[model samples]
Target: MKQWLHLSAVAVFLTLLSVFPVLAQEEDEIDLSQIMKAAEKKSLSGGGFLEFQPSLIGLNRDSFFYQLNFGDQGPKRVGQYDFRVRLEGSYEKRTVGLYFTGDGLLRKGFQGWDSRARLFEGYLSLRLNPRFTLDAGKKTTKWGKGYAWNPVAFVDRPKDPEDLLEALEGFYVVSADITRSFQGPLKTLAFTPVLLPVLENLNSSFGKPGHLNFAGKVYFLLWNTDIDFLFLTGESRTTRFGFDFSRNLKSNLEIHAEWAWLTDLERIETSQDGRLSTTVSDEMSALVGLRYLTASETNFIAEYYHNGAGFGQRESEAIFEQAKSPSAVPGSRTGNSADAVFPPLLGIPNPMRDYLYFRTSQKEPFDILYFTPEFTSIFNLDDGSCQLIPGLTYSPQTNLLMRLRGIFLVGSEHTEFGEKQSNYRVEFRVRYFF
Candidate 1:
């Protein structure tokens, strides 16, 4: 009787062991299904980053722009601190979607404490089908094929050569995209049309006030090469036509180009005696570039740019000469006389006519992971001035990044880079993403 009882107990235990795994697996499947369904039904998602940047700026006290803007009395070197936060979110439901990206910045610099907030992008997108879509609100069109310079970016803001990949502020516009696929050398075609309005306190910086702008782009993928034809016209800005192309000659080598023609564009100049002058003429701007990647994880980029609308050698010299005059002093003239003459020279990046860009980056040297070092040089072919930047980026862990870089200017007196506010600058940046 005792032996029978023991055998029955062992059988009962074995039966429970077999049943438990099946029950647990079914429960796990149900939980996983719920989680996946919840994810699919989620209508809103968001992520952003926090950044801190500090810089040590080496002032060029004897420089033309420094003397004109800060006068003779200023620090030789100064420290600046910056804090930034970015918030981006997206909502999607069926054929409609909404997205927004906002940025806030606080800084303590030579001008003292300052803070500002901006909506980088906010738009509503309606996708009627895979081939047709519409977008309305502030957004970046991001046209052109050049990496460092985009003379053909008619509907977008200019790119900073030093930070070519950085996000830019957008213009409010209504736009549509129509796309089609083909089975030949011309594999794909797309058309984008944009309507941008410049009103008081709305997209006012885009151009003159009270005008609606029209722009369009036609894109084609012919023989595996990308090409685009673009145009913009309105009362706010002069009419312009643009063309851009990008092609890959090899798996590791790529080439790109951009060309723009503007009608009745304006160029401002200053005379030796502090007289301001303006010129209106037709202009053509262009850029050509190439990118190559080597087997050792090294990338090289080169570009040549011609700015037909930029200041000439004589014009730039005259402006620099005027900057040395007494009236160019910060408070020498009453009621902002200096504002009219200096804004053009100081505000625009690379205001000269001819330039060359060269850059190289090496990834993960010496078997180190998540590290990259880069060097960049921007040369002023007209003035013989140049700027050199060396930088390093490292990520020790996920969602965290650190970067350090230095910028040094090389030029003689009476040159474009020689008149910069800072001859050298070193900065460190840290970012955390969530």
Candidate 2:
């Protein structure tokens, strides 16, 4: 099956290559003036992508997550296929505009075929002036300075560390943006404020229902530095204050940082003997990162993250021990037991107290246009566990992309990465836009 998938991908690549010349030839015969006139008159536009991804996973049946999720019927290895379709459209009339984006996925895994559909983003906006705008409906406010992790993204959903660039589902909200341009050291200033309401069956996943939440961000471009001050308050979640900054130290080097403080943040811990406990206190999380580009077009990124809400090494070890034990019950465990406590602790991207992330990518090596190879690693500073990912991406033609990647988890028993279901995974993805 894996060989077939590889051959199929190769066939598609060749087909696209053959069609590219013909498409280019046809493009040269088009009238540029007519195209421009049509573009000026067209107010509605739509585009999206269809993606196919096949993966092979080497499972660790003895891992804590594997044991809890698959129980006694777990498989040692698995092959999975995924198909995804994303559609996005926008319509503009004068100062008013409407935008929507939706996606659907079909997957065949060890369990069987499964499907899901969701609206990722949908919003209406009114431009009051050149520097002011208002929007309402479901939207994503991607705020933060960190690349892999966003410690100060108080108003947005948590990012997937493995795929930090993937689009995420948005929350319902009303928001406004006001901007002002300056003439001196301060180049620009912007203010964004949002009101998010959580009611029955609407934005219920964000926090406690039946409450209104308020969040805002103040941005400034001063002395060649990008800075932001953020805040969130209300009944749905804990009130939080955040600050983030980004600046370029040189033409090829940049630095960024984020810090957030949450009031009355909750922390949960499990004991080695299967006992659980919870505490509430103010928490602080911070991240510092840098990006650099070398003369040879090689890009590098490194980050250090401190997760105040994450578990301690001892707590994580206790949870894993309980999960590996045969006497642990699956369904009857409560908040005070390790069986029920491991899910939330292990499900997060980085559930440990401290982490270090590094990534390097070489662009268009050997003069191969639109081709890149990258390597990334996330090290758990607390438990000495780590994940290594290496990938190659190629774009043979416009609006088409292909990527092949591998993931390897390394750790000892009772460590974070060692408790994952899959020790390694290999995947290939082909995506085409229309």
Candidate 3:
């Protein structure tokens, strides 16, 4: 933390030096009285966002949320969902930056802190020519490009409390990314090879393992189709590799897949005889999605993600039956006993998990790992809101933005809610963007 402070101090000082050329100006024009005012107006800026949110739980449990957004230029909106703001500047090979983005819900936590601030991302990136991009900040991991890829929900609104808590923490990510990029009119492709160095404050386990990784990707546009491919190799000692591909199908539908192969991967393998061996198993996965526009007034999408090792999950709220009989609720006996307590009066917990949760190579760019089960809503199709997202956006009077959506995921008779095999959600939002 102290190091970052020093770095920020040095950056601020250099910013003044670089932005203001006292040397280039006439000596007589250097007025001490106006120095501070000049920097204040030209080099300083600030902005913030505001929002309101309320939810009615279908399982009809404890469902209530109020959120706000206050930041300098934030995240990009997904149609009308989210936004991000990032500040970037460079001096020679060095750079100074601060960027943050959040969802529509802005809930405060203990001591008036923003709930998203705990893991909201902030980082400094340094590029040494075309060979490497070194970064250190509150970095989100580069996991499989599934729904669960992001850890910071400050700008990404999640529906469930369980999903909110599983979000990743802000860690000091120090990574060296070496890349070759190509951007053109006809088609473009770039391949990046990354290596993560040591990170002092990583959001990992007490005995978190370090990692080595090798990954590259390509992109092409043939005909009217857009194609993207990503491949990665990772390890603590042994190694694992992942591959992903996405392509537009027919015009209204899309398809994408993710796969991971473990190579004798081992964190720590110890036997009763004290002999040690490290082994990593291989895994495969595929995600298929289709979206159709029916008469423009009604549109729907269907997405399915399957893991060979049964380790894929979608983010959604976990409802606790208000217990008509009190004792029927099983209160604290539930999993993650501490989670039973109610949320802070003003702050909210999302309770959503990864769309395909897996964040590896903590604290560094080389931190590569496999996916984990979030046990969220995507697990169900007919009953859960994840597998199917059907909604419509309308302009009631051209000045108003209105949208209505229904999400359904079918739960298993033996999983999620055990005997409860159904859950559903309906969301309606109106926005006046001026």
Candidate 4:
């Protein structure tokens, strides 16, 4: 049954590829800054454009059990998920472009995730003046120059998305680049999302207002390099402040690093140890990495994320219990189980602050609840052009990532039985535009 479904998906994908040319124009050079002149042409007529992308992939993993007091532990099989699909697009515009994006999985079985969605991007902009412009709606507000979240490579876009979304919502922003003329391309944008009545859910069937989100950015460009420094604050107990720096090395080699301080917990409480904490342990996070693409489109990347694991009271009693009575509780967990691909390093500190051999992974698409039109500004996210997800992508220009993929979850080793409960996902998509 799974194989049949996969085949059906492939057939649908092929059909879309066969008609891309008829439905959308290929990438063309359009001077957005000069569009006002184009508008003056009496023969002007509006025409739209589009870009479609698709990909497939497979994954598998298993966990192992170990006892520190006893000795060496044995490996245990744990998780796995297979199947794929990721879609993204942009429509033609005389000035600023219109865009949106969605990416996730097409699961093969219960172990596989059914699907995940992301609003990615949606918004509109018109340069109101040379130094400023008004932007409204959903859009990505980026900041910083780091890997845990910065725009850099491809295998997947080398940036994070969750942090990006928190930075751009119901957007209204103004920007200025005093250095653009003398120091090359550099800009600074300062703005905040519109303030409206707060509601319970931003993502809902009825569509109600959510919490207030405010953010700002300073973008610097020099010799093909991009640096985005940001500040963001939002409701739902969220506050993301970080920096993302990415350097494009000759269009083939790329590198990046990131650092964020997230300490806006709504409440505080004592843990089982009776230790009341005012601050979330290591509210700070960091990552660093590099990427290189060969002539054949083959790519290579090595990245790392240190989530600073100083969550006080994280001193687990599992190993202690196992030593006293391994049978008292089989495969006990003192540290709670979650995906290991992006494990949290909550307490580690960097005295030297050197960003070598340590960085965060764009291990997964940061969110699972997102839906928006393909041409809206809320969906141009590609993981590459995001602030938090560190990813790498590759395309020979022929395939255009038709071979790319979505999230990398499902199978991974688990020392506990609870992890086996990784549930299946559901997917449904309805799309149209005016």
Q: What number of clashing residue pairs does each candidate have, in the order they appear? A: 0, 0, 49, 63
Ranking by lDDT: 2, 1, 3, 4
TM-score of each: 0.89, 0.89, 0.47, 0.43
2 or 4, greater by lDDT: 2
| Best model per lDDT | 2
lDDT (Cα) of model 4: 0.37
Residue 352 displacement in candidate 1 (angstroms): 1.2
Q: Which runs in model 1 stand beyond 4 Å of their true positions?
A: 1-41, 269-276, 330-338
User: Where does the lowest 10-residue lDDT sum fall in candidate 3?
Assistant: 62-71
The true-versus-predicted C-alpha distance at residue 251 of model 1, in Å, is: 0.9
- Cα lDDT tens digits, model 4, 341-375, are 11322111211122222222222123312211110
Q: Compared with the true structure, what per-residue lDDT tens digits does model 1 show for residues 1-434?
A: 99999999999878876877666466554566877875775789998999999999998887766765677787899999999999999999999999999999999998899999999999999999989999999999999998788898888888887778778889999999999999989999999999999999889988999999999999999999999999999988999998999999999999999999999988876567656688799999999999999999799999999998898777777777665665555524333333466675656899889999999999999988999999999999988999999999999899999999999988877788887878999999999998
Please, what are the lDDT tens digits per residue for candidate 3 over residues 261-352?
Answer: 53442222334454333335554445555444443322343445543322112111222222212433333335232124322211332122
Model 2: per-residue Cα lDDT over 1-434, one tens digit each: 99999999999888886877666477566677997986785689999999999999999876766766676576888999999999999999999999999999999999899999999999999997979999999999999999988888887889988898899999999999999999999999999999999998999988889999999999999999999999999999999998999999999999999999989988877655557578899999999999999999999999999999998888887767665565665423232334454556777778889999999999999999999999999999999999999999999999999999999999888888988889999999999999
Alpha-carbon RMSD, candidate 4: 17.8
Candidate 2's error at 431, in angstroms?
A: 0.1
Among residues 3 or more apart in sequence or in different chains, the pairs in candidate 2 whose N, CA or C atoms overlap within 3 Å are: none
